[model samples]
Each structure stands twice: as structure tokens, then as C-alpha cells.
Target: MAERSTPGSTPGRLLAPPSLPDGAELVMRVMPMPADVNANGDVFGGWIMAQVDVAGAVLPARIARGRIVTVAVNQFTFKQPVSIGDLLSFYARITRLGRTSITVHVEVHAERDPVNPQLVKVTEANLTYVAIDGLGQPRVLTRQV
Candidate 1:
């Protein structure tokens, strides 16, 4: 019998993942280093989640024209493991606007092969953020023209 190799068996290549919808925006890109990896050799999920939160809040913060704080993470799903050296990109869009809070949907994709730049979505989450005053209290979000 002869040995065979899968598409993703290569050290720095990502197997194809599902494609995203049209008009999706790219928010941020980050590459996790050794410091971000856990003892078990995988990147920390919380670290990724934190990045998502920051990515999700960016637009709302601009809309509110002030500071904000993450109030909740409605839903989070990790579809794949993140390893060191993978280039992570966060994509986000505003989903809802409330009196003082904004809900955002964020998707994270990792580039496994630097040269080829193939991306695989590894996680998705919905996060809510509340606009805050200088004193760190929730403030009303007024619509901007």
C-alpha cells in the first residue's frame, strides 16, 4: 500500500472552509505568537474571544463617538483549533442598535499558508457593547445623521 496525504496535511496550508456571504468587511488581522499559546501548545480561546470583542466594538464606538464597554457575548462557537503562526483576521458588522447598546456579529478566519493566503473561518460570535460615559457609566446612544 502507498501512503497518501490529505490537503491539510501540509504544515502550513489550510483546508478549504465554507465561503462567507457577499459584502463582508474585514476588521482586523493578528498573528498569535508563542506568548499567546497555552502549555498544551494551542492558542488560548479567551485570547481569540477578546480579539473578537475588540473587533466587534470598533464600529459601535465610532458611532457612539465615545468610550464603550463589552456588556455581553451572546453566542460564541469555535469551529477549529488555532495554532501559533496562523494569521487571524476578524470580520464584524453591526447587527442591532439599542438605546445604549449595540449588537455586533463577528467572524474570525485564520490564514494557514502565508504565501498562498488561504483563509479558514475558525470562530464566530455575537457581542453586545454599551456606550459609556467618562465616568464609566452607560450612556444613551443617539442616532447620528
Candidate 2:
């Protein structure tokens, strides 16, 4: 689990990737398109960042049981290049819960090569989201305990 995802024993098959985190939740999944690529042809960091923000908010939204707004991206790391056609999976877990904010850590894994099969980690990020009221003002989180 510390290294690459497990592979299938037989040909033309692949085992699923290892658990991203012990209690992480699967929040989102999407495949990149050529339009999302950068000059180098890898997925653009900004586009990935945006998707991460969306993926990171899932838990906070549930905990808050309402609307939330992104307050900050505490950290983001791109471990590997993401290529088009790779099936991307985003897993997230709440690392911290505050009175009005929740911090979530997210990891993105890419499954590539339909025939040969490869699973690689593409990104990981720490993001903070704040529960907000209809007025767009920070509101207290119900699960602050």
C-alpha cells in the first residue's frame, strides 16, 4: 500500500488501487480531456486544482448539512502527471473540524492503460471549507463537537 497499486495476476486484467486512506470517502471521479491539458500535454494544474476543491468539499458539506464556501487550499501536491483517458478517482477525509470550517485531505489516483493496466497517484491536497449561510457569511458547523 505504501507503493504502487496492486496488479492483477492474469493478463488483460488489473487489480483495483489500494485504499487511499483508512476512512476516506470517495467523493468524485472524472477523466481528463485533451482540452484540460497544459502546454506540456499533462493536465493543467489549475484545472486539477479546481476539481480538487470540488472534491474536497464533499465531507464538509455533509457535516455542515448545508451550503459551504472554500476558504483556502492549505496544501496541494502533484505527485504524477495526469494523462487524458485515465480514470481518475478522488478520495477525501476530514482532517480537522472547526466551529465554522472543516479541513479535508484529498488524494487522486489515475487508472490508465485499459489493456496493460496501471494505477498511479496523480495528486493530493489539503483544503479548508467554511459553512456559510444564505447571506454567504460563515456559519457555525453543527458537528463542531
Candidate 3:
């Protein structure tokens, strides 16, 4: 399902993926506001990076079955500028699993003009998450059946 750009208004444009390569799933959609923009009038790269971190952590948090913490963000590339009123969608897939950490590959796509519904991959990144305990200590993840 496509999420609306504003909380109460209908989505001006659908942000659904035109196609996913393979083994990837849509995770979440976010709309950036003016507050998130930089002095250049484009959404800040830090904001996009933060969203990617959140998207990368989702599955590992579920699989770890407990508290998790962001351990690392290996690489992030910004391919396009995100503007206000654009719908941003994140897609993620687990790429590697270690005893206590998991790597997630995330792709960010933006709807240039929601009214037109055209989607473009604006950024991509690989993030690693580690399972953590209540005290914020690393813990090994138990494999799920």
C-alpha cells in the first residue's frame, strides 16, 4: 500500500516500487518537510541517512527478537535530491547474518512529483545492526526456525 504524503490528506502520488530486483521487500514510506531541508532547499542528506538506518534496523530487530542498536553504517550514496512534497519509500533485505549482528541492504526511492507517480532511486546504503540487551550490551542472536 502507498502511504500518504501528509498525515490526513490522500497521497498526491503513489510511491510503490516499479520493480524490486529480487528478495527485497518494501519496509516504510516517509514524507520530508521543510524542516528536514538544508539551506539549499533540498532535503538534507543526514535526514535520508537517518531514515535508512531506521529501515535497516527493522528486520534485525524482529529477527533478533529483542532490543537492537545501530552498530555501523558502511556506505551510503545519494543519487538524487529529495524535495518537499516528495514521497520517499524504503526497501530492505537482510544481506548477512553474524552471531550478534546482521547486515541489511536498503534502497531509497523518491516520487519526484506524486501527481505523476514517477519513482526514482535516490539513495542506497548498507547498514549493520547488532542485537543489544536492556543494558545496551551486545548479545548473540538466536536463529529462528
- The TM-score leader among the candidates is 2
Mind giving the per-residue lDDT tens digits that candidate 1 earns over 1-145? 1122345576533344347544356778889989888779999998998888888877788889888889999999999989998878787778888999998888888877644555688999999999999899999988642
Identify the leading candidate in terms of lDDT.
2
Superposed on all Cα atoms, the candidates' RMSDs to the truth, in angstroms, are: 6.9, 3.8, 4.8
Give the clashing residue pairs of candidate 1, or none: none
At residue 28, what lDDT does model 2 achieve? 92
Model 3 bad stretches (over 4 Å): 3-16
- Which runs in model 2 stand beyond 4 Å of their true positions? 1-14
Clash count per candidate: 0, 0, 0
Clashing pairs in 3: none
**lDDT, candidate 3, at 124:** 91
Candidate 3 lDDT for residue 62 = 83
lDDT of 2 by residue, 1-145 (tens): 1133335455434356666787887789898999999999999999999999989988888789999999999999999999888888899999988889999999999888865567788899999999999999999887753
lDDT by residue for model 3 (36-96), tens: 9999999999999988998888888889998888888898899989999888889999889
Candidate 3 lands at a TM-score of 0.85
By lDDT: ranked, best first: 2, 3, 1
